[model samples]
Target: MKKISLILSLIFLSIGLLGCQQSGKEEELNKEISKSTQEITDKPTIIGEIVQIEGERFLVENKTEKLPDGRPDAVWFSTDEMESLKVGLIVSVWTNAIEDSYPQQANAKKIEINEY
Candidate 1:
């Protein structure tokens, strides 16, 4: 009975410590995100056109596609998220690349297409 009580107490103690550590890590992450948001919010944006469209993915090839400066050959994203992106359709996209996953996609957060 004493052994079982000791084991349960140790488990509870470990869980409590882990929970506290995770909460601290979460707060640290939130602070980092807030700092990053402030840095990017000051930058000017390129509101470019949708050059191509695919299933759940769209491309907004900026005119200066010559440089290796992180512009997409074809931007890709979800039509559900950016409702204006349909096949053979042109739309304006606001986005940035993940950097780690380069060339394959330039992920767009917002899209707007011209209506007739």
Candidate 2:
């Protein structure tokens, strides 16, 4: 009877330890997920020259960095913030990412003209 009780206690202790470990892992996973979500939703800024403007969208050629594809980086902006923007004009754009697009498009939150 004593041996049976010891075995049962061991089994329960093992299960309790496993449950605690699993909950800790889950909490760590939740924290990592929250951090990743924050990064994805965070706004980013870009400084570049206007390559083209079609309606309210501006095609910008990034001056500060090249894209991962080894090509000069470009981004599209959607806003009425700067209506007088002309091609080759330098500007700084603040934007939020648009989901599910290649070359990564963003909706312009603000635009500043760096050149007159």
lDDT for model 2, on a 0 to 1 scale? 0.77
Q: How many residue pairs clash in each candidate?
A: 5, 0
lDDT of each: 0.58, 0.77
lDDT per residue, candidate 2, 6-115, as tens digits?
99999999999999999999999998877545432233477789988888788888776886877777778888666678899998877544544544577777777885
Q: Which stretches of candidate 1 lie over 4 Å from their true place?
A: 1-19, 28-46, 68-74, 79-83, 86-90, 96-99, 102-107, 114-116
lDDT of 1 by residue, 1-116 (tens): 99999999999999999999999999999988875454322232333456665676765554555447665454455446746455555555554433334334545555666453
How does residue 53 of candidate 1 score in lDDT?
58
After the best TM-score superposition of candidate 1, give how far the Cα of residue 68 lies from its true spot, in angstroms: 4.2
lDDT of 2 at 101: 53
TM-score of each: 0.47, 0.55
Model 2 ranges with Cα > 4 A deviation: 1-44
